[model samples]
Target chain A: MESKVNKYSKQFILFNSIFIFCWLVISIFPFLWTFWGSFKVKADFFSRADWWYTVSGVNTLIETGGRSTLEAYINSWIEGEFWRAARNTAIVTFSVVTISLFLGTLGAYALSRSTYKYAFWILIAALVFRAMPHITLVSGYLFPFFQLKIWGILPTTIIVLVAINQPFTLWLLYSFFKTVPKELDESALIDGASYFQAFRHIIMPVMWPGVITAGLFSLMLAYNDFTVTALLLNQQNYTMVPKINAFLGTVEHGGNYMWAVASVVSATAPLFMIVMFFQRQLISGLTTGAVKG
Target chain B: MPHKTFFWFFFPSGLAMILFIGLPIFSSFFQSLHIETEQILIEVETCDPFGCEMEVQVDQEATGLLREESPLGRFNGFGTYLDRNHLAFDDLGAGWETKTSIRNFISIVLNLPFYKSLLFTLTFCFSVTPVVVCLGFVVALSVNALAKSIKGPVIFGTILPMIVTPLIGSLVLFWMIDAQGILGATLQKILDDPNLSLKASRNLTWITLIIYGIWHNTPFAFVVFYAALQTVPQEPVEAAIIDGASRFQRVRYIVLPHVYPVATFIALICLMDNFRVFEPIIGFSAEGVAQSLSWMIYKDLRNETLMLFGSAGATSMLTILGVAILLTPVLIRTWKEFRTDR
Candidate 1:
């Protein structure tokens, strides 16, 4: 019986390890391939005659007189003016994270403290808003923004993104705020502090972890957005994601598909670093609501 | 908090939501009921041309003035909703009358842009959600059994797919799976078909997209379930083990029940996210074979000649209705939970 149990367990472990190994390959190989291929010439990367050409870089040597080249990166970044889009992405994400947290922290704190039915209704309304496909909202925004003459600018996109980020931000921070002992703020209130003062002095210090996690998510939303930014912004004001999309359109004309590949790698680098550093917070943030429920 | 205090605290976020999120739904509804103005036409007589011919030409200035006067165009009164690009009510009625069979009727209905997109969107949503849940649970279990030192790195690697921007993620996969790319070439060799391309067929495109959807979403579900698995009570698992429950039986009875609620949460989120699967379609360039409702609205608004605001708006309204329907069960459950908490 003991030998039989051991044999079954050994089989289970082997299966699990093999499954994980395959999954890891599936998860990690595409990025590695793209990153490596981004350095090679397009001919070698997409070589139909020989797939090994991608690894050997024979075509890359013929085209660029080297095993790899930075020509794609230079072409995309300088000639294509991708830096402008990266700058715009930075501005948009920074402003969005700041404004979303500002509004979300105050609103979520209030919602967490209040016992009113309206507060519950507001959350439910936000839930509905969260479910609406962002393109649907962009459809509504186009005419109005055109009418107001605010289309094709950074501030307009930032404000719209901040509003869109609000629902998720409020929910995340609200859950975070719920975990804080109410007595922390109540004690400050009893000490003759105004409600705002209580929030500022008592609640703000302990709320950083939650606020940071929410800010990371908000930053990502603003950074990763394609629909709103693509539709709302003009050519000059494009963010990175939309700009990458625009590269797809113009690639065939210039035969600069490598520029797009290079830009994709460039765009994804920061997100890779972010995940590297913030994996713990991100995992916790993901599970907070799920585990609590 | 007092009402006065609470009001001030909530005001900024409330105003933002009201202006952008709340108002858009109403604006989209109103826009859906209006179509663009018709071009004004006037008779012009050419005395020397073909013995005094009279021609009707578009009066551009008059048309511009009309458009400027009412930018929402003329009130359409559900006409946009019933048009061929949308519900295609007339086409549906005609097809119904002349139907050869139910399958033919269904095919005819699906040939319409709206129905075609709806079918893909629903298929993508429902198929991706359950698979993600199950895959995630299995991955979570596997990872949970890993040694402590390697788990963090494994998690960091796993979450990369979920964390990267969807467009870029899809593009990375798409380039690999292009006809001449490594994976595509390998697939051709394996299948022994020189001309085979995943992008060439409708069913294959759908499969590729669904596969991409599963790839993109499973990590999120995995992360959530992994965390949930960590919190699974040890007592019950140990009790089952001591009670002579086999490994599978222990997992089935103890671990499954503990993580069931988290599974539901992951499913809810996956459904909501997958229903709006637009980016992958673009990245894969699968719009020729498959389009989501979001993609339809995007196409209308991006029309090269003139923006089809009314058509886009109508589709927006319908898509919003779909979201509401998807959300109904969760909302009902939340309402019940809220009542119980009170």
Candidate 2:
């Protein structure tokens, strides 16, 4: 019986090991394809026969001074106006994440620690707001904003992005805040630590992992977004993902392998870097997002 | 600082929420009733390329006009809801006429397309959620159960899919299914027909979409389920195993029941998501057949007619009605669960 159990356990482990390896390979294939493809020249990208060569057969893709991978990277950077999108994405993400974390932590504290009459109602409202789609809300805002333009149209678009991302940011941070025991707040209170101070000190420190997870998720969301950004942003203020819209039908647009390589590289690199840098936190944060209150 | 005097802590967040999130709901309600319009100059140009000055006419473009005291307002006690409802479906196709009879809404609820979409959505929700939940649970449990040495890789490998952007995945999918794509080429060869294609048929498109949805969504579901699974009481699972329960039996009787709350939560959200499903639909072009309520809403939003507003309202109404009908039991159950627990 003991030997049989050991054999069964060993088989289970072997099965799971294979499963994990397959999962890892499939999971990372797109990112890997885009990364490698980003290094190819425009000529190499377009010729289906050239890019389609089997791995065992040697190809001249590397030998002929084709726009090597590094050249493609440089062209993608310069041509895509990626820096501008990155800057906009950064500022918007930082502002939204910061404001959301600050307000959400406090609001969550109030709901958790308060003797207020409307705490439950506030929590319910927050959840409802979280569940409401961004498009529905943006539809109403579109009309008024159309009449009142701001800062030659750029700042207005960024502000709209901030507003759209706020609910999720708040919801994510609030979830983190709720996990802090009420007793911690009471203890801080007994120690004469004011609510603000306790939140800033005790609660915030303990919830840092959750906060980082929420903050990063918010950043990922803001950065990867296409729909609202495409609608709200004008041509000059186009985000990286929405820039793909330019490729839809234009001959100069979608035909080049260089552009495809550039797009995949520009979009995926930052996310890949972030995920690699903060793998644990990203997982935990996503985990939180998956479950409900 | 005092517990009772912490109202100041709530003000900023409350004010922000009210201004941003709260205002939009109210604004959507108000905008639905307005005669909305945009001035457009129709440039009448001969087919001369870049050599002609065009005559422009300002079309009488007062649009999205609401009927004063529309009967819908009287029918529903909430005038705003009625106005919103009128605006959503008023402008659908180029020449689509309004069918305001009670029978139309009933038909919408009971029609083949509507019901089929619902069934597809429900199947998607049921199958996808369980697969995700089970995979997530099993993976997390296995990882947790493993010797400490190999656990990290298991978790890392499972989550790599979740980290990449969906846009990239969709693009990669495009390449993988396009005629010259790896799978497409392989199939063309295997079938001994040069024209054999995945995108050429509706059945194939739906299959690809279902596969894509599963592939794209599994990572998300896995992450959530895995996270929830991590929190499952180890003691109970161990006790079940000690009682000589087989792995499947343990998961069924003990693990699944314990994870029921989280599963229910995931299911409700998944239902909402599966129904909305605009991104993948737009991305994959599962063709027009992939139209969900949200896609219809998106289509309506794109309509040049003040019909956009009416269509949005109609779509929203349909979506809300659908979700409310389907989710009432779940919500009631959730309420009961929350109540009983408290």
Candidate 3:
């Protein structure tokens, strides 16, 4: 029995270590692979033999007298208009974050503070909207926006994005606000502050973590979104996600895909920074989003 | 809260939602009833004995007027929905009335664009979600068993998939799985067949997309379940061990049940996310192989000259309805939980 137990335990440990190791590699390697592949010339990266030469790209650089890491980055930036897309993405993300946070907070605070059934139903509506894909929402926006002649503009897309983000933001913020004591805000109201003032002073400061989390979520939803931005934004207003997608379809450098790899890497760099800085918040925010909705 | 306070607080978001979301729901339904008309210019030629004369004739000028006057054309209620790209009542009828054999009829119906996309959508959701959930639970449990010192790096690596934008994440995987890429080459080598390419066939593409889905989403489940695992009780496992429960049996009885709710949570999120599986199809260039409803909407809406808004509207409505159908059980359960809490 002791020998059998030892054998089983050893097998279990070995299995788990292998599983975790594989999981880590599967999770991390594709990204590092693509990031590394971005630097190589088209010929080198697609070469069948000595693929390590692809990542190194030094031999190819010497042979062709061109195409290095900096070359790919430069080509992707200039040819892809990386700055334009990045600027548009930044403008849209920040606006969506600020606007969604403002509205989502007030609406969520209202729902959390109220004792009415309407709050419950309203929240359910938000949840329902949240569950539907943004493409569905964009469908609804098309005709009306066209009639109003506002299609494919930054503000139009921003408003639509905020509206779509509002549902999830409201859900997250509602739950977050529920954790703050009702008495805290009410006490501020009773002392001297008006309702808005109380919210601005007491409620916002009290639920700072939730606010940040909700803000991060709004930024992410706007940033990572492909369907709405892809459809709504005109050529000049393309965001990073859609721009990267457009790169996939167009022929470049004999279909090298290095520009695509470079675009993917550039688009992903900020996300890496975000995950590193806000991993805990992101994890908790995602959990709250999952469990609450 | 005071009524005025509530009003002020909820007003802006409520207005935004109503204008953008609430109105759009009704607008989508309304738009679905109406199709847009193209300004088709027809040149009619009349040949005389002396010479030939050409005169420009405008057809469907009323439609052109209507199209110009209103963003929505004539309301043909339920017409777009039942058409070939949607419910395909005509195709169904054609299949039923024409085909003599059952197998052939079934094939005809499945070949309809609407039904093919619906099939792929359903297949994607079903195949990806459950497997990802199980794999995620395994990873979560494994990581939960690891020492504290080593777990953080493992977790950081794991979250990278979930962290990276879905489009970029899937693109990375797509590149790796290209026939000439490292993983694809290695896979071909392992099979001892140079022509063993994943991108050639529909089945292979579907499998590759599903694998990518699992790889991308499993970490989310892992994190959720890993977090849940910390709250698992120590006493029950000890009692199970004392009762001579085997390691597997102990895990089966205690650990699995402890994580059941979290697994269900992951499953719900997975199912919903997978239902609208649009990004991968585009990233993989798998539109020929896999066409999802959301992608259908994108394709329709992206018709540069003809927006196909009515068709898109109808598909969007159906997609939302599908989401509602999938979410009904979860909603009911949550409502029950809320009532119990109340």
- Please give, for residues B1-55, the per-residue lDDT of candidate 1 as tens digits: 8999999999999999999999988889889999989889999987884599889
Residue B138 miss distance in model 2 (angstroms): 4.4
Best by lDDT: 1
The CAPRI classification for model 1 reads as: medium
Q: Of the candidates numbered 2 and 3, which has the greater lDDT value?
A: 3
DockQ of 1: 0.62
**Model 3 lDDT, residue B19, Cα:** 86
Q: What is the C-alpha RMSD of each candidate to the true structure, in Å?
A: 2.6, 6.5, 3.4
Task: Please give the C-alpha DockQ score of model 3.
Answer: 0.56
Worst 10 residues of 3 chain A by lDDT: A1-10
**Weakest 10 consecutive residues of candidate 2 chain A by summed lDDT:** A51-60
Q: After superposition, how far is residue B110 of candidate 1 from its true place, in Å?
A: 1.1
Instruction: Report the lDDT tens digits of candidate 3 across residue range A99-180.
Output: 9998988999999999887788888788777788878888888778877889889999999889888888898988888888
Best by TM-score: 1
How large is the i-RMS for each model, in angstroms?
2.5, 3.9, 3.0
What does candidate 2's lDDT look like per residue over A67-182, in tens digits?
34466456445675656666666676676667666766676666666554466557656656655666665565565565556422556655555555555665666667667778
User: How does chain B of model 1 score on TM-score?
Assistant: 0.95
